[model samples]
Target: MKTILNALAEPNRLQIVELLRDGPLTVGDITDKLRMNQPQVSKHLRVLNQSGVVEVQPIANRRYYKLRPEPFKELDTWVDSYKHLWNERFDRLEDYLHKVKRKEVDDE
Candidate 1:
């Protein structure tokens, strides 16, 4: 998971992942869409592939890049584990706000 996060931490790699979210694309396609040179796009793709965030398929001489679902599913599960903590914090904040509002009304 750290590796996946590190890979996605790079802005260019994150953009590549966003592009792949729509569908698989070749290096050329990404380069064109991002207005970046081929070598730069390829480098980002390599990092994404090494981190298991994306997979490459060689079809006829072109490499197609697409997202790997497993990493994202793992990330989702990790985030979901913290949901209850966030909910509790939000509930406490709500209760405090209500108490403050009531105090203000009484003072008025």
Candidate 2:
């Protein structure tokens, strides 16, 4: 998970992941879409692949890159663990707001 996060932390790698979200693409396709040179795109792709965020499939001479679902699913599960904490805080905030509104009405 740390590796995955580190890979995605890079802006260029994140963009590559976003591009792959639509579908698999070759290095050339990513380079053209991002207006980056082939070497730069390839460097980002290598990091993504090493971090297990993306997988490469060699079709003849060209390699197609696509996102792997496992890392994302793991990340989702980790983030979901904090959902209850967020909801509890929001609920308390709502209660406080209501009290403030009531106090304002009484003062008026």
Candidate 3:
């Protein structure tokens, strides 16, 4: 997970991942969409591959990159843990607001 986070921390790498989210893309396709030079794109792709954030498939002569499910699943699970806490806090705040509204109406 640390490796995944580190790889995604780069602006270029994050854009690459966003491009891949639509579907698998060749390095050329990514380069065209991002308007980045081939070598720079390739370097980011290599780091993403090493971090297990993206997987490469060689189809004929072209290499296609796509997101790996496991790392993203782990990330989702980690985020869900925090999601529950935030939901609880929001729920409590809503309740307090409702009570205040009721108190205002009672005073009127």
Q: What TM-score does structure 1 among the candidates reach?
A: 0.96
> How does candidate 3 score on lDDT?
0.96
Task: State the lDDT of candidate 1 residue by residue for 1-108, as single tens digits.
Answer: 899999999999999999999999999999999999999999999999999999999999999999999999999999999999999999999999999999999999
In model 2, where do residues sit more than 4 Å from their true spots? none
Clashing pairs in 3: none
* TM-score, every prediction: 0.96, 0.96, 0.85
On TM-score, the leading prediction is 1
lDDT, each prediction: 0.96, 0.95, 0.96
> In candidate 2, residue 52 scores what lDDT?
92
Counting clashing residue pairs in each candidate, in order, gives 0, 0, 0
- What candidate 3 gets wrong by more than 4 Å, as runs, is none
